[model samples]
Target: MQTAQRNSLRLLQWMMVASLALPLGLFVFASAVSWVSIRETADREIEHSLDVAHEHALKVFETIDRSLSEMAEIIRDVPDADIVAREQMLHLRLKRLVTSLPQVKSAWIFDAKGHALVNSLVVPAPEIDFSDRDYFKAHVDADIGTYIGEALTPRPPYQGAPFFGVSRRRPSEDGSFAGVLQASVFPEYFESYYARIGREPGSYFALGRADGTVLARFPIIDRDIRLDRNGPIAKLVAANPMAGLITVTSPTDGIERRLGYRRLAEYPIYVGAGLETSAIRARWLSTMSQHLIFGAPATALLFALLGLALRRTRHLHFEAERRQQAEEALKHGQRLEALGRLTGGVAHDFNNLLTVIRASVDLLRRPDLAEARRLRYIDAISDTVTRAAKLTGQLLAFARRQALKPEVFDVSRSVQMLSEMISTLVGPRIEIVILGSEEPCFVNADASQFETAIINIAVNARDAMEGRGRLTMAVGMAASLPNAAPLPQHPYGYVAVSVADTGSGIPPDQLERIFEPFFTTKQAGHGTGLGLSQVFGFAKQSGGEVAVASEVGKGSIFTLYLPRTAGSGRSRQPATDAAAIDGSGTSVLVVEDNAEVGRFTTDALAELGYAAKLVGNATHALEELATGAERFDAVFTDVVMPGMSGIELAQEIRRLHPELPVVLTSGYSHVLSEHGSHGFELLQKPYSIEQLSRVLHRIARRDVGQEAASASS
Candidate 1:
């Protein structure tokens, strides 16, 4: 009896200890998790602010570049004497230009001797010699393209805020440096824009030269501050010149911050945004304190109710699982948000293009328009249409719905041929290295799309490396993919084309989403974010897959795996410029649900010398065909309709009229993308009149050939 009592007492003591520790441990773990989440949130906010600063900086510099280009054009042919004679008139023009751009403080044209010829700041410009100025000196000897000078206050009597000079060297007719066209860009303009966007306290923005000279900054400082050449931020920029994120202490203020920075593509400028580490830590501390306030009481209550501790622990586990589920739901919502952004971006671009087209059309309708003006309007419309088509094509490529013409080609040869072109595209700073296996790796895919994919990947690598890095393109064969299922044609193996870059790698959070449409790490206006997505889609649509492996601060490698095919592979024949054949005396049956489209189709066919009959829907089309009142040479129908889809209609027509040819058309069709055109010729929407005429003519000619063969038999 004594032994049993001792054992029971020990058991109760141990149970009590576990009960107290369990809740305390859970509280600590939850607090740590909360702290991490808060830090990540702060980091993302800082990164977004950096994106805004980058975009603003690019716009500011681009406007300056445009203004300089205009000035250069204005004086391209004029002699120095003419410029002196037209000084007053040019001064007014320059003033107007500067006034239109809020960021530009003034404009000046300096002759080769550094004498001010014309300036926006004063009429009958003062005979000020700017030979001592850094911008003038920099361009006096060499043509360094565009030179963006450090911040400097204007000569005493005429100043508001310090400004930087963005100048381009003007060339003489003999290709020698003739003068400099300079624009004074106000740093306060950028500072004001930054202040508006960065409303959070302890946040800062800086615009600096690649060589560490500060051009503009928010939280304005009185003294000039230049970054140390060997400092953490400068080293980071040297290592990864395009863009990156870092956590460091600010040398000027001694405050630790999490900073994100991007370097401009065409200029020696860098934009950075950072959040004070103290502020982030304070937020984390506040959140943890609230959790502790709530958790402490609950922990004590559990300790008091030791008998029910086991049940309470189980409930806490259930809550944790529920929280995980909620987090997953939040991730789904984020994906939806991304999709919304993609749609909005697409809509915005299309709206702008449409606006241009509408204005051009309105102008063309004017009765008093000159021939030159009319031709310009027509050309504008044509260019807009072409751009619109390219946009839609990119979208289709991302969706994996583009109509591709597949052919068997040697991947190794293609890479070899593209190496020179890639070198040219990426510039001299990037070294292009090609590695190919002795054995030819053949694959069946679209030749043009394959080339495009390679170029896109190379361009992406260039940006990631900031135009200076080694890009290795390797072609070989692989038996299996890294994270993909075995291909249906596994017996033949796969052609693996890998592109490796020594550049800043993608972050862990962004690695999985690199292929998402409209997702990019590049600064705005420098990328459309469709390149990798296009690569992804083209690979998948070609019965292959694209895989990426990246390590932050190291580099990245993107590999495209295509199913291998036997044979040496045939060379792609050059496309001939075929003329549209006349469609005289041929009859076409047009099946379209939309009234306006049907009318347009009939009119276009009539203009092309084809007799066409239009019907509202597939059912009516079938009825008209059943009547046999009018013999049809060919059937042209849309793929998508209200009832009995065009694909189904085509199938029915083929079943009844075994001798007739059918052509299908659509801007986009899920059926066509997924199941193909059911062995019929397909014409894409927005096709030219010549294309329409040719397709109809081909079918009519085929029908005639068939009839003649039957008669001869």
Candidate 2:
């Protein structure tokens, strides 16, 4: 009995020790798990913050670039002080760029000699030399790109606050480096948004240059962070990867931080967002405190169950996160692949066109080149540029982002005009036949985009036909058709432009997906598969829709339904301008900034039997006209120039000489976008010789008729 009792006591003591140990083990395990969870959450949060910071930086950088680009282009136009001093519109625009964006400190134009010629904030001050500035040095050597520089100490009387600058190089009319257009942004601008960006108390954020110089940092603890010469950030940025993570000790403070950083694709700037590991540990401790209050023995069972549950939950959470990451990566891969394919196809076409242009240009350089061959080479380059433009314009329309300058135009006439080009696109084997309505089929939409859709459809049909079949293009008003697609409200009527092909048709299952972007039935390198999608987007964007009827064996018919406006008999397309009127002996004033463009305009006009006098800018043009030395029938000017935009110049001409027709031309003009054509004729840039001649002839003839009619009355 004594032996049995002694053995039982010993066993009981051992059991007691194990009971206490179970709860202790559970607590330790819980603490470890909570720490891991907190760390994971912190990592995710900082990563998201990093992306936001990156986007913010990119947006700011882009705005800077865009502003500088416009400024640089304008700076090339004006050569004298009177033009810059007397220009209110230019001053207002520059001031607006600075004042509109809260982050922008100043916008200024610096001459090649690094003298501040014009400023957004103040009147152009004399002798403000920035020759020693880092931003200036970057642009002094390179003619392309906007450069982000290290922080700059405030220039005298400006205060002690430091600022960083972003600058773009401006080239002269002859393509020689002229100056730099720059903007300064204060670090405090970013600091103001730190609360929002780094929401967590112990979180950190920073903006750095590509040279690994950290410009701004949150916690305001570290203002100057000149990174190690060849550290991880330097190496990572040099590699040019978009995003990555790094753990480094803060140079400003001794604290260790886990940071996520992202780089801007176009700019040499990076944004980093991070949190201290101590932050995570603090949160983990807080969480453990809540479950640590229970009695050790009672908590033993609860801890056992909780541990299993927590482990399982974490496993599932990890799996969910992994799956999500995998899906995102796959999506990113697909997008990159599509972009690669698209770029590859575009590059091939551009290369072919450029090759022709290069060869023609080279041939032209020869002193003894024949006149006939010279003209042919010039025409070839022009034609190739047009082809390249059409290709890119189609892509832009498909993106649905190109600004639409809607005009009332006849669809039938446009189709008629495009027939010759369609033939060229479809090749000699394919026969293109146009079927038009006797009545006018008019739509209010962008005419070039409308024609592009037609071209894309015809090209698609030609491919379906294997380049040898009949392609019929038909256009008519909805009421005239026996059966047409329903019209969208708002437009008075609708017009159907049908492109039918006698070729192998699409499969029933593939028809629905054919309009999806990058979904090509053709083999690789053959098609971008954007044709149908372009047609669809154009129609929809024009307040219209696209429909199709297909059969496996029979050829398919694709119809584009566009919103129509009030109209009557089929109108003649203005391809040769007014075929009856020619610009013979008509003196035109050509006001252009770029020397090459001015030369081309003069040569093209001279070639077409018109008298052309070229001047550098509006001031010179005005002075020439003011002298009354020679009579000018019309004025053709570029819309966006330094001292005054073409629209403003045209206004001045109209005020001084209303009878003299003023023609405006632009590739893209903010003046045109804001104020519109304003009753003057507009010729889009990259215009052909024929287009220029036709426009000039039309305006001159119109002006002559008006004068004649007035005199007779």
Candidate 3:
């Protein structure tokens, strides 16, 4: 009896001890968790605050920018608005804006001499001289654009004080400088907007220039203060061009905060948001506290009960192993997908290089080379380079990074051309059929990529057939697909090109994954698995779709639906005046920023028997034209250069001298729209000596004929 009583008492004592210890441990854990939770919550709140402020600041900035741009555009179009009339109209516009927006502090105009013509402030100051200001000069001399000044000013006489200004040059139709159109708005206008943006009480908000000139701040509420680029916030500004959250220690508070920055390119400003670290930690802490608080005691009881009621179930371990394997497989698939995209981009650039080399070599293989063994050797050198270029192009096309020269071409013609190559490619084992629409279906696709895709499919089909099969090409329209959007159509229409193969069909399970990058069922050495992926990428990039249908016992069909058009019939025409080239006495002005390129161009022009004068940039070119008044027959310039683009220079020149002919050259031709105003001709870059000579001759002849006709009239 004594022994049993002693054991029972010991057990009871142990239970009491555990009960006391549990709460003490819970207290420590809960407190730690709560601290973390509170900190995280605070951090999140701060971030939210900052984000809201940044967004609000951006909204205000955009509104101001848009309003000013509209105002400038309106002023430019107002025909009746001479100096006096313009002052009156501007006052009316300013009053309306101030009343509607409630943020615009003032709007004013500066005469050519920088004296205020009109002020929109409530108690407007008398005209002040701003001629000495660099911004004033910048606006006056801008030539083609508005000049935006950094945020700084004395508080305005208007209800809303302290303003930044944007000034644009106003010119008369007769080519005389009219005056400067200036729009000024209060910094508080932005700060107020920033303050009201959703954010935690302690969140920081700032708006600044790309160079870190602080324009507005919410908490600090400072105007005309610039942030040091070497500071923490400035570092965040420098790094966060695309805008995402980052963690940084606050220089002001010495506490870590998550920072987010958004660049407002339209306004050329930066919006920054900062959230406290404590805020993010708060949520984590709260959940963790709740989990531990209730879970500990419940878990202890459950453990005790589970131990008593435990029963083993078979196959649990096997199921777990299978799940782990599947997870690993999924991870590997994702990695492959990323790698495929990277490889595709690399391949695209390689193709363009190959195209250039191929063209160069083809041009070099002249009978004139037969006169000397030296000439033959040079031709061979060109051929070798061309072959290597072709290989690089093949790789880049597979990778999908090559810049595409897309055009509407017949799908049937593409198939027919591929058929000619298929006999040798498939070793006479595969029979190729070209089934095309009688109506001539067309698609906006790069012809080179299209050919590559067909070849890859043929290779795959050959492999599936084990070196023997029938490949049927069927061209038609795809009735709407489940997930596919309607293909974009030009004046003509759209069609679907289907390549079907009779061979060992793909397994049902692998069918869905067949188009996935680097996925293959072929023997290890037979394929790279990028063939189908390349086809899919090319189709997608070309604004088309690819579809697949297959059965294990039957065959497989891949449909490439593409937009079509009636043949443009405007076939690629070779230069007609190539044989009759004469650039004698043709005065040409060449505007290029690169010193080496400019020198090479002038030297090349001189060699081609033309007079060439090279200027450093568009600004210098414009200045030269204005001051020298040199009557050049043509102005040849690079489209993309520092200061002013070739397009802008062309526009300015046409305004000044309408009779001058322009030929713009660039590596990138997509920006031709910017040159549309002057109807200038475009020449793609990396031109050879012959191409330059031919273009110059053509321009010179055209100009001479026009001048001659005008003189006779």
Candidate 4:
């Protein structure tokens, strides 16, 4: 039985390893293939662009030659007529024909005398006309047939007339040549063909004639490009090959362009098509880059799956593995809950102790002492109190009771200010890098809580590094959640502050439990185990969430997603600046349920020189107001008491007094419960003597009108 069991276990272990190893190896192989494919794709695109341009150039040349040949054929079929009569009649007909064909610049007839006989243009024939011009010369060379001449443009007198011409001899019945007929087509006729090539932004095409004249370009050519090397169109067709490709500077943007050129024996000129190399390659570049980017995470996931399979294969005891996991989780939770209780208890005791210490410090200051000695004692007291306060804050964080008084703040500024403090706390052995955001992301959260949470996470990161590693703190908006993981729900939009550490990564077994209170991997006396717990609590209380992800031997990342507040990036209100209030003295009645607190308030008001009346219950207070015998400026009362609720009583008083000022106060009172209402202000309990004096002073100074409510509790 033992032998069988051992064999079974070995088989399972092998299966797991094979499962994991195969997929991981496959992923790495696929990634290598993908990279190669991307490079090859770019190369292929460049080649394809060259091929298309070459084809287009050939087509354009063919079309132009075909059109010219057809015109020549028509001219050749016309029988010869009397030279003088034909010249006069032909001039009128040729002008109409040129007008009918927009591409035709001019059509003329020349006798062997080298004088223009008739022409499409209204200008008279030149005194020194040449019937033996290149078009006529070409026709003569071809016997009595038609011939298409090379691209030609007026050199001087007709400088703007850049065009190509075709010539044909009008033959007599005996097969002798008559006066030659010639037609010139302007360059603008080719504009439509060039415009068809590049339509996308950043893409352009140009046509360069064999002689290096840029016939047309989709985008306007620049002056600088005229000074540079001619475009690939001209360069490729320069040798006058049937078809070829080359690279040259663009005539528009001066960007290097690749062009395909084609020439034909039928036409005297070569045609070239140009496309920007970058534009052609851009499509494939984007495609391959996208594939490469997606491949990273895809490959990672594939390997992870394989690793999971391998691990399962390696472990034959499936039941035991599950049991182990459950046991660990249970232990983690219990430990955390215990830790929370422990921290809470410690915090409570410490606060009491701190209070006593503070009282003693205050009392000690009253006694006379040596100036230097007193200063030293005072410093010690302040230091101790401050440390105690910090400790209690950590406890509150762990307990999820930290106050979240959120307001707009600049994330970058906060990070920069904390850089020095983080360095000091993290120690010299650890490197701290603080990266800040360029744009401000504001959050409505308690700044102190936010600061503390970041610090706690940093401390945890430092600890993970075992005091010797690099830690990076960054503030930025959360990346849109990928399809695989939807964004976790949040009360407010999120801004993520992340702490990353290059140190010992968390074990898989401990990852899920890291945020649990009191869960620690460190030995006793080395850790409190509440660092992450406090971070988690603080995040949750602030209407946010904390997430942690890690891999063994790699590293860990902790992200705090906070609520985005309205009016982002706005300058925050200064906490120390007080809103001023002025008051006019009017008769006032004070109501209180607690004697010491009440007397304290009344006495403070009396010292401020206000005639104040006091009562104990809401009913009596309301009755006093209902009676017309006495009138008061404001009704100040305790909210929670034996007789009546403060809010209800306030409602009644408002109805009765109508114009009286009613302010409620309480210790553990929800007197300010808005109840879906607005416009009232309730003073908090344990109010200072000065604070009460101010409240009355303001109330007395206000006008008693049917203003409803100006503030709310």
**Cα error, candidate 4, residue 358 (Å):** 8.1
Query: How do all models score by TM-score?
Result: 0.52, 0.44, 0.42, 0.39
Q: Report residue 471 deviation for candidate 4 (angstroms).
A: 3.8
Tens-digit lDDT string for candidate 1 (431-453): 88899989878888889889989
Candidate 1 lowest-lDDT run of ten: 482-491
Please identify which of the two predictions, 2 or 3, would achieve the higher lDDT against the true structure: 2
Error of 1 at 108 (Å): 88
Query: Number of the top candidate by TM-score?
Result: 1
Q: How close is candidate 1 to the true structure, as a TM-score?
A: 0.52
lDDT tens per residue, model 4, 77-171: 45334444555555666776676566668777666555675676754555556654677776554464445555565744556746656566655
The Cα RMSD of model 3 versus the native structure comes to 14.9
> What global local distance difference test value does model 1 have?
0.86
Q: Kindly report which residue stretches of model 1 are placed more than 4 angstroms away from their true locations once superposed.
A: 1-321, 416-424, 427-433, 465-470, 485-489, 502-509, 550-555, 576-579, 701-713
**lDDT of candidate 3 at residue 128, scale 0 to 100:** 68
On lDDT, the leading prediction is: 1
**For model 3, what is the C-alpha lDDT against the true structure?**
0.68
- lDDT scores in order: 0.86, 0.79, 0.68, 0.64
- Model 3, position 577: C-alpha lDDT score: 35
